[model samples]
Target: MLNLLQIEFHKMRYNRATKIFLIIYFCLFFSITLFSSIRFNLGEINFQLAEQGIFNFPYIWHFNTYFAAILKIFLALVVISMISTEYSNQTLKQNLIDGLSKKEFILSKFYMIIALSLASTILIFLVSLGLGLIFSDFNEINIIFSEMGYLGTYFLKLVAFFSFCLFLGVWIKRSAFVIGALFVWWVAEGIIKGILTFRKQKYGIKDQISQFFPLEAMNNLIKEPLTKLGIVKSSIGVVNDVNIYWYQILIALIWTFIFVWGAYFLIKKRDL
Candidate 1:
């Protein structure tokens, strides 16, 4: 695994496009996170949650996880570009000719996906912890540790989202087309969700199926903390509003498996 990762990094070292994407991704991630943290810490935005310690221990996990999740698209683009570049350059076939098994090639990409997701999650965790310590009052262990499940939800969302992107990269084999299709699919799903929601409200329809959409399922894994901060209304009730749903996490896991399996199947069966 280490050797495979090393090879992957070695390839990335010479890839100008990969470097450019990564530079933009890190800049965007840091800029957004730092700006939000500084703004909230400085009281630039008036909100009741800040007083109740929304940026404080425990609660900070929820806020930070959400902010970090917003950057997953960058990671997705990284995966899409990497795999698609391999396809474009015919490196995948070259590797196979050089005695690398198909499975190893796919697994190597998966290893990179896991490593990137874990690194990003841990970095955001540390950032959130540091900000909380510097700005929030020391509270009880229970209060400081509660709602940490948001971190797990955040991690799951990244892995699932990236796996889906890998599947798209393998299936589409074109960076621009895959990325554009992903954007279009996301927008289409949002439109379908909205239309279904409107129908449910206006026609009194009982089908609540919109949440089952791939991205929507991943999103339902983490509800909006702003709603709990009294900034937005809870679609469900306040009692169950801030909590992460196990079923949603299960759905995300299932979809992650499907996307991964689909990618492997397509890669194995198709000609390079």
Candidate 2:
């Protein structure tokens, strides 16, 4: 298992696609930070009423949720392609035929995915902290650390989401199909959910159908106020109001296990 993991890590590190994605990721990271810092410096962006403290929670939440969310999507696509390309290129079969257990093969990919997700979250957090320092007059380090409790939940969400994407890729065995399905799901789901909620409220059936969507459960981790369901508030609030930290974590883990196991089962049972 250790050897397989090492091999997987090496492949991830050396892959040209991964290198290009990392370069793009870093470029976007710096660009977003610079833009935010410039806005803050120009007094064009005021996240807090008092400029003496670290920027308010809303700024961090917005930056993380919107900016980091795009990176997560690209990362998921790369992960899906990593495994799917191997399957498509017949390299996965070659690896398995070379004496590697099917279990090791699948688990190595899972470990690599999880490791990459954690690394992505950490890098985002560090960027947020560094940008916070550049733009805020307060003790940015302390404020960044204060909000760092959500890092674990964010990591879990990314893992769960990406694992599901990988499972789709493995089950479908086509990179284009996986990417298309993901794009449709990500784009259409929100619109469909809004329509459903609007229609359901008229008929008083809102609670019966909301939980069926995976995105709803997964999004509980980020707790975006605009996307939140149930209990509408009249006042503007910067903090996350959801108390489902443990529940979100649990849901993420359950989904991750299901997808990972599903991928393993498909890889083991299907003809290469």
* Candidate-wise lDDT, in order: 0.81, 0.70
TM-score of each: 0.88, 0.81
Determine the C-alpha RMSD for candidate 2 after optimal superposition of all C-alphas.
4.5
Ten contiguous residues with the weakest lDDT in model 2: 225-234
- Give the poorly placed runs of model 1, Cα more than 4 Å off: 39-52, 230-240
Span of 10 residues, lowest total lDDT, candidate 1: 230-239
RMSD of 1: 3.2
Q: List the residue pairs that clash in candidate 2.
A: none
State, as a TM-score between 0 and 1, how close model 1 is to the true structure. 0.88
Deviation from native of the Cα of residue 126 in model 2, angstroms: 1.6
Overall local distance difference test of candidate 2: 0.70
Candidate 1 lDDT, 156-220, residue by residue in tens: 88988999898999999999999898999999999998888889889999646976788988888
